[model samples]
Target chain A: MRRAVSALLALLIFAYLFGVLLKAPIPGDYRDERYNYYSPLSGREANESVPDHYVERGEEETGSQNIVTSIVVLYRGFDTLGEVTVLFTAATGVAFLLSTQRSKGEKEKKKEPNFMASTGVGLVLPFILLVGAYIFVHGHLTPGGGFPGGAVIATGFVLMLVAYPRFQLREKKVSVVEAFSGLAFAVIGLISLIMGLTFLENYLPKGVAGTLLSAGIIPLIYIAIGFKVGSELSAIVSHMKGGEE
Target chain B: MMANLPFIMVALFIAIGLYAVLFKTNLIKIVMGISIIESAVNLFLIAGGYVKGGIAPIYTSAPEGEEMVLPTPQALTLTAIVIGLATTALLLSFVVLIYRHYGSIDSRKIRGLRE
Candidate 1:
C-alpha cells in the first residue's frame, strides 16, 4: 500500500513538472537586455547588463582570460569563500562523527588489493596529480578551476587508498596543508582590504591575460583553493574509508 | 516544446529522486535519491544559462560578435557541485554510522528517535 501511494505521488509530481516544462520558455531563446551593461549601483536599466559587460571588459578589468574565473574569484569571491567554509565544515563533521569508532589500528584486517589494480594505480597516480595541478595553475586561461582540479587530486588519493589497503595518509600533514591554504586564501583577501580596496579586491598587477602568471590575485586565490579543497576532500575520503572496516 | 526536452528530463530526474526519498525504506536508497535531486538541480541551472549559438566564456578563442553563455550560472553550478560533494560525503558518513548502530539501514525499523 505504501509503495502504491509513493508511486502515485511520484507520478503526480512528474505530471506537474511536465506541465511546467511545457509552458516554460525554451532555453537560449530568452535573452534579457539587462545583462548587457555594467551597473555597480542601483537604478539604471541601460547600464545593468552584467554578463555582456563582463564579457566585454572582464579580461581588461580582472586580467583573467577566463571570464568564469573572474566571476568566481573576483566578482563573487565572498560566496566562494563561504563555499569553501561549507566544505571544510562538512569534512570536519564527518571526521568527528566517525572518530567515535575505534582507530584503524584496532579495526579488522583489510584484504589486499589485486596486484593488477595496485600496479595500475601506481602508474596513473602521478599523471592524475599532474593533470590536477595543471587544471588549477591554468585556471585563468582555461575551462578548469580549483574545484574540478581539487576533485581530480582527491580521486588520485582515493585510487591510492583502494589499491594499497594498508597505505595511510598522514592526517597531520593533510590537516596542515588544509589549514595553511585556507589561511592563505583569507590572508590574500585581507591584503587587498589593507590596500584600501574592499575585501578580496584585486590589488596586484593585472598581467597579460593569456599568460600563465597573469591575473594577479586570481591564480594565487585559485591555487590556494585547489590545495585547500584537495586536502579537505582527501581527508574526507580517508575518514569514510576508515569507517568501512 | 521539443527544445525543452532537457527541462523535461530534469523534471523527471527530480520526480524520481523525490519518489525514492519519500517511498524508499532503505537509508542508502534515500541518499541516492538526494544525489539524484542534486544532479537534476545542477542540470536545470546549466540549462538556464544556455544561449543560442553561444560559445564558451573564454576570451582567448571566442570569435568576435559571438554571444557567450552566461558565466555566472556556470560558476554558481561549480560551487553547487562542490557543495553537493561535501553534503553527499557527510550524508554517507551518517548512513554508515546509522547502519553501525542499528545493524541495518531500514528506515522503518530504526525508530529510536520516535520512541
Candidate 2:
C-alpha cells in the first residue's frame, strides 16, 4: 500500500512536469535559417540550419565523410578528451579498490570451465576483435566510432573472462596502451597548438572525404580513443573479476 | 499531443526511476534506479533533437531535401552514455566495498554512512 501511494505521488509529479514541458515554447520545426545561422565559435552567420551547416560544410572542413565523427573528434575534441579522462580515472579507481588483499581462506572457489563455453569463446574471440578493429578503423566513413568499437573490444575481454575464470589480462600492457593513447591524444592537440591553431585544431591536410585513408587527423584521434577506451574498460572488467590481487 | 508521446514516455521512465531510488532499500536497486534515470535523460536529449521528418545526420548519400536530426544532441548523448558507464562502474565498486565492510547492502542497516 505504501509502495502504491509512493508510485502514485511519483506519477503525479511526473504528470505535472510533463505538462510544463509540453507548455514550454519549443519551436515546432527547426528548419529555420535564422535559428541555424548563428555560430558562437566564429561569431558569423550562415544561411543553413545547424545540422545542415555541419552536413553541407563539415566534409570540406574536416575531410571526413562521417559528419558525426567530425563533430565528435574534430569540432568538440576537447570534450572528448575530458570524457576519456573520466573513464581512465574511473578505471584506475576501480583497480585501486579491487587491489585490496583478500584473506587466504576467503579466496573464491574455482568452478570447472565448461568445454563448450571455452571452445565457443575461443572460436568467436578473433572475429570479435577483428570487428572491433574494423569499426574503429572505418570510423571516419561508417556509422561506428571509437566508443562503440572500444566497447566491442571490451566485450571480447568479457567473453574471455566468462569462459576462463582464471584468465587474467596483463595489467602492465593494458596500462601502457591506455597511457600512450591518452598522451597521444593530448600530444596531437599540443601539436595543433604549436601550429598556431587553437587546441585540437585539425592541422593535418583534409584529404578526400570518401576514402579509407582520408579524414587525416580524425582517424588518428579515433584510433587513440579506441585503444584507450578499450584497454581502460578491459582493465575495469579484470578488476571486477578480482582474480589478481 | 501525439507528437509529445516520446516526451511523455521519457517522463514516465524518469518517474519510475525516481520511485525506485526513493522507496527501494537495496543498494543495488538504487544503482539500477540511477541507471534508469540516466537512460531517461538520454532519451529526452535524443527526442529533443528530433525534427518533424528528419533523417539521420549522416552525409553519405543523404536525400537532397530531407532535414537531418540534430547531431549535437546525439553527440552529447554519446558522451553522456560513456560518462554514465564510468560512473556506474565506480558506483558498483563502491557498493562492493560497502558490502564488504557492512556485511549487508541494506540502506537502513549500513550505519557507517549515516554519521
* TM-score of the A-chain for all models: 0.90, 0.88
lDDT of 1: 0.89
Error (Å) of candidate 1 at residue A39 is 8.2
Per-residue lDDT of A109-174 in model 1, one digit per residue for the tens?
A: 778888999999989999999999999999999899888888889999999998988888888899
Q: Which 10 consecutive positions of candidate 2 chain A have the poorest summed lDDT?
A: A27-36
Cα error of candidate 1 at position A66, Å: 1.2
Single out the weakest 10-residue window by summed lDDT for candidate 1 chain B.
Answer: B106-115
Candidate 1 chain A worst ten-residue window by lDDT: A33-42
- Steric collisions counted per model: 3, 0
| Model 2 regions lying over 4 Å from their true place | A1-5, A24-50, A101-104, B112-115
Model 1 achieves a DockQ score of 0.79
